[model samples]
Target chain A: QQPVQSPQAVILREGEDAVINCSSSKALYSVHWYRQKHGEAPVFLMILLKGGEQKGHEKISASFNEKKQQSSLYLTASQLSYSGTYFCGTLGGSNYKLTFGKGTLLTVNP
Target chain B: DAGITQSPRHKVTETGTPVTLRCHQTENHRYMYWYRQDPGHGLRLIHYSYGVKDTDKGEVSDGYSVSRSKTEDFLLTLESATSSQTSVYFCAITGDRGNTEAFFGQGTRLTVV
Candidate 1:
């Protein structure tokens, strides 16, 4: 099943903070985060497998709530490089195949 | 980079013509996938192969077929291309099944005119 991301698009200033939420209708075994720039392939950011778990990468971090079938990605003190579409991939159902969400477009301006 | 390469980074084909996209990998990963990215659909899976000679359909498999005859190569074929098939296709590879990083290729921008 595909996850739903909130705030299809957001604008932020440099050094600002933002949060992207990913929700699913099915039980998830793992959740993944990826960032893609304009005309570029998506790059992996982080993965969360356990409930109530929080993981960070540089100024970006994410939390997974298995019970609620939701995950939130937090970008703190955003930078110009953080402007891109953020996607959340979930592995559920009977197989490990990941279904990604529509994605959240984050634009950080100077 | 994960040593994944997609051929024909850009292609423009006529409708009703058959088209095939190639994906090659040097990482020798066991799992490979084909996905198309659109404006509102994000990334929709076309097909995937877990091993040589083994393939399965994805959510958007209509008009598309896949074959994996070798460990490093996966091919996606469109029997009769249509304008709806115009999208950027990406090939991905991953070694592990759970909590592992998946690497993506540069992507092939295909236009069916």
Candidate 2:
């Protein structure tokens, strides 16, 4: 099944912070985060393996809670370049397929 | 940037016609995947291959078929294109499971009339 993402869309001002959440009903072995611009393919941002770990990239950070089967992407001091759609991909069990969330559209204005 | 390339970046074909999208990877990754992106749906996996001749269906694999005859190439074919199949297709390659990031191609935008 596909994961669920909260806050379908968010608009933020420069230097503001926002959070996008993803939850899956099935047990997940890993959670992957990606950002896609208009009319472009999704680009990999980070991957959080099992064990409920957290990973960071500059002002963007993500946390995976294995127990809850949920993950959250945090954007701090947002930049205009961060204006795009964010998606969370989850892998579970023997499934090699990465089920993605409906996606969260983030618009950061300068 | 992982030497992944997708052919026919943009294509337009009539319904009921067969369309094939090819993905070539120079990185020699063992795992390759095909996904489609739509308006509301982020990216849905169509098919994936772990090795040559080893493939598996994804959630949205009904109308789409895929093949991986070589380590460096994977192909997605639409047996009979439909208007609903008109979307952007992406090809991705990963070196290993979990913990690793997959690199995506520019994508192929296919339109069916």
Candidate 3:
């Protein structure tokens, strides 16, 4: 099954912070994150495989809670360039397919 | 920029006609996938291949077919396109398992009238 993302949409100003959460009912082996600009393909952000592993890319960071079957992405000091839709893809058990979350649209303005 | 490229970046076709989207990868990854993105549904997998001639259907595979006769190429075909099939299609490649991060192509926007 596909993972569920919270806060369908969010708005932020420059230097503001926001969090996007993804949750799945089944245990996850890994969670992958990506960002898509308008009219473009999604770009890979980061992947969290190990339990409790956190990765960062510039002002973006993400944490995975294996026990909770959930992951959270943090956007710190958001910038106008960060305005895009974020999606989380999850793989569980022996499933070879990566199920994607609904997605969260984030708009950052000056 | 995983050396992945999709052909026919944009296409408009008539309903009931057959269309094919091609994805080429230079990295020679073992796993290749085809996914379609819609307004609120995000991206949904259509089909994938673990190796040459080995393929499996995904959640939204109806009306869609995929072929991977070689490791470096994966093709998605719409046999009798419909208006509902109009969307952006992405091709991705992964390493050993599905848990690994996938590299995506720019995508092809297909419009069926």
Better of 2 and 3 by lDDT: 2
TM-score (0 to 1) of chain B, per candidate? 0.98, 0.98, 0.97
lDDT value for model 1: 0.90
Indicate the worst ten consecutive residues by lDDT in candidate 3 chain A: A50-59
- Compared with the true structure, the alpha-carbon lDDT of candidate 2 equals 0.89
lDDT of 2 at B84: 96
True contacts kept of 1: 0.64
- Over A1-110, each residue of candidate 1 has an lDDT whose tens digit, in order, gives 57899989999999999999999998888888999999999999988886554443666788888899999999999999999999998878467577789899999999
- Residue A84, candidate 3: alpha-carbon lDDT: 96
Q: For residues B1-113, what per-residue lDDT tens digits would candidate 1 score against the true structure? A: 68999998999999999999999999999989999999988888889888999888888999999999999999999999999999999999988764577889999999999
Tens-digit per-residue lDDT, B19-86, candidate 2 = 99999999988889998988888788889998999999987999999988899999999999999999
The RMSD of every model to the true structure, in order and in angstroms, is: 1.5, 1.2, 1.4
Query: What docking tier does model 3 reach?
Result: medium
Q: What would the TM-score be for candidate 3 when compared with the true structure?
A: 0.95
**How does chain A of every candidate compare to the true chain A by TM-score?**
0.93, 0.94, 0.93
Cα displacement (Å) at residue B62, model 2: 1.1
> Against the unseen true structure, what C-alpha lDDT does each candidate score?
0.90, 0.89, 0.88
